[model samples]
Target: MVTPRLIVFTDRRQAARPLDEVVNRAIDGGARVFVLREDDLPAAERAELAARLGAMVAGAGGRLVLEEGPELRKCHGLADLVGAAEDGVDLATLSPIYPTRSKPGYGPPLGLAGLGRMALAVSIPVYALGGVDSPARVRDCLDQGAAGVAVMGAVMRADDPARFVKELLTA
Candidate 1:
């Protein structure tokens, strides 16, 4: 089994680089999933990126999470996921949930108890995102019922991104 490794949340801020390179690096970094959260891009751009990313992740035997926008309500299985994030995603996530480089004044993090409630409410597996900065937080989320943690800065800003991911996988 893959041991449910880390997921990577790639947003519009990262669109400047070529999608192939970005996804390739993430795959090499032991990321088992990728959630494309590029809200600023037009539908065409988003779909284009999604198609490319989906191919890459699927080729590597990983899943690609595409935020369905308000369309999530229109989708069959995404409602629960949408609900969890609205509730206590961080709590569900274990520690810092948002990315460290996120815009200042992001909402407060949801601790373990809060996330546990979300886990109870939702059917699909939940992965903690946002300011996840430590290995301990990763362990905590797993213990608290999150499927895994998704990182942005922790891996993106590192010197050896793939190696950093390996460390995270082992951690």
Candidate 2:
């Protein structure tokens, strides 16, 4: 099966613009994978949002993943990687690969070597997350054996999300 190389993470709290607008723009600009990381929303609201986003993503020939909530199909977070693997998750994100302002207090950044080790340790595809705002960073993650790179602030805060996503995909 094909895996997305560029994944956009959504956090309503960190968004400078409307979340849906940013997401739609990114999708239009070729972002094929998205992780709904809005942990602040109530369960019902979150599920509703996920359903809506899931439909949108599917219509665009993409995939939507949920950050650790009720969704048992996929998982996100470095600590959950092992459990996710054991639960048969095919694609997982191991985050904070680099220092990121988006996720404060998550812990110290895991450098390239750490990322490489985690990627090697996992049997499933590992997408690097955190501080991935540029093409070079994306390349670095790929070089370190990551299946892809996931980002939040980079696209969500862009003045032109579509253009940003286009540039990111090219990178």
Candidate 3:
């Protein structure tokens, strides 16, 4: 099974442009993986958005994973990762690999060392999420054994989302 090298999480509220516009530009820039994290919206609304984005991503040889989707499971720490792995999840995200504003008080920020340990502990593909806002950081995550780097505010808030994504993927 193939694993994404860069997974972008969407937060429409954080996007400087329309969600579809940003996603389209990212796709044009070679982004192939995305995650929909719009739990604040109504279920029907979220589902509709997911379906629309799924088609767009699919057209670009990519995929969109919904936060509440059953196909993939997301986890925070090693223990959760272990349990998710046992459940045969398609993939998982292990987060707060660094201090992040998005998750100000989610928990103590899990440093790179913690990320490494968690990545090794999980049998499934574990994506490094949170505070991966730069190319160097993205590379750090990969070096630490993450299957990919999952980002949210980076692309969402970038004035040039496409360029940022290209840089992140190449990094």
Candidate 4:
């Protein structure tokens, strides 16, 4: 039932540098957790990548939540969150707290109120997602009762991923 306060998700398509490099720098910048979202890779490739990142982070006392991996299940809405808890997931991600470029038309965008309600409605930990890039937004999510925050595109596209990690950690 332990979860880190920040979880950085990977999106290779938007990466400004190699994922390992970005993740390594993030780790160096104090990011202690990550979610491996490169699901497009074949099972073997994904497993290899996971093992590599897992080892790297493990040495730093960090960890990775693989997409659909046994460790964590990401939930996009309240119902999904409830179901995940019922199915034994300890934590999940709830999204679109603001408009995001990553999912252009995917949502009408739930604000902080939605995040609060969802967190209150579920027993398991919930991480706020979507448009949560800056320190202020990260603070806003925590204020609304999010257990932590999860981010992808912003860090993935950042020219200085380490600095990005440091900025978010300041929240």
Candidate 5:
């Protein structure tokens, strides 16, 4: 849809370093879309972080999407898919398309068929999220009709985020 081939999800708790530091590295590594998923922060704090991240992403000619907001560009889990278009969402991420330790307990994995089903159901671009850690998985998701893939641990925990992102983008 929007042509963002790779979206990096941020979780403060799961990060190995400061969120900004990790995100900056990712941006340098070719990540074009970033989703702020820190739900535990107070509203004001979250907004502040979003503003900061927005600036960073913009500097890299990328985009930033908040997990919670009235923003036109947004990311959503499968359960939130029903009214995404009505809510004015430009992009949505239907998650757990495969089993993932990064987002355990959300529900069962959607698999390829379910991913395709949801992708076809929504007019907005649907990104496959969860357990999409490899280049092959990225290709698989794209083949299944996903506009792209959203990842957490794959890039966040990587020793070389730039290289990891480059591999994903090239794949």
Candidate 6:
């Protein structure tokens, strides 16, 4: 199957403008999937943010995925979210699959082989996250059965987020 498109992990708070504006810009910038990962905000606030952001993204013909947090608690994050793509959420992002941006003090990196095993247990496409600094590694992730790779600092903090995404998507 053809890859849907680049999935951007957007930090609504990181942008100077409102969350809706940031999301609109991201969609305009060719971001097909957005993971609403504002961990600092409360659950209710996150839900509200997701609703607004979701509307803006859908208006732009893009998609939004709400991450409940790193632990996938209380119906927050889950692989099942992919099934709700039309209803608002789109695809789950299982992070720290290898030492990720969220939890640095966590256990050892869940190497690709181990990650593949874990991903096999789930039904939806899994995006390998954490420590992804090279686009070539995308092949390894896909080989290990990952749907895709999600990067934080590797893309957002890059000198060129667009170019970084191009390389990652092409990889």
Best prediction by lDDT: 3
The local distance difference test score of each candidate is 0.61, 0.80, 0.87, 0.86, 0.82, 0.61
Candidate 2 TM-score, C-alpha based: 0.86
Q: How would you order the candidates by TM-score, starting with the best?
A: 3, 4, 5, 2, 1, 6
Better structure of 3 and 6 per TM-score: 3
lDDT of 5 by residue, 34-123 (tens): 888888999899989999999999998888877764543433454577578667677777878889988787788888888887787777
Better of 1 and 5 by TM-score: 5
- lDDT order of candidates, top first: 3, 4, 5, 2, 1, 6
List CA RMSD, all candidates. Answer: 5.7, 2.6, 1.2, 1.3, 2.4, 5.8
- Residue-level lDDT of model 6, residues 40-121, one tens digit each, is 8897997788888888778877667666543221111334343333234333444565555545765577778865775566
What are the per-residue Cα lDDT tens digits for candidate 1 across 136-167? Answer: 77777667777777677666555566676777
- Evaluation by lDDT, superior candidate among 3 and 6: 3
Better of 3 and 4 by TM-score: 3
Q: Could you tell me which 10 consecutive residues in candidate 6 have the lowest summed lDDT?
A: 69-78
Clashing pairs in 4: none
lDDT of 3 by residue, 96-143 (tens): 888887777768878899999989987888888889999999899989
Which one is best on TM-score?
3
Residue pairs with colliding backbones in model 3 are none
Candidate 4 C-alpha lDDT tens digits along 25-66: 888878888899999999899899999999998888988877
**lDDT (Cα, tens digit) per residue for candidate 2, span 10-63:** 987767688888888899999988889888889899889999889988899988
State the local distance difference test value for candidate 4. 0.86
* Residue 109 miss distance in model 1 (angstroms): 1.7
Shift of residue 155 alpha carbon in model 5, Å: 1.6
| After superposition, candidate 5 runs with Cα above 4 Å error | 71-82
Candidate 1 segments exceeding 4 Å error? 1-3, 12-19, 69-99, 120-123
- Higher-ranked by TM-score: 5 or 6: 5
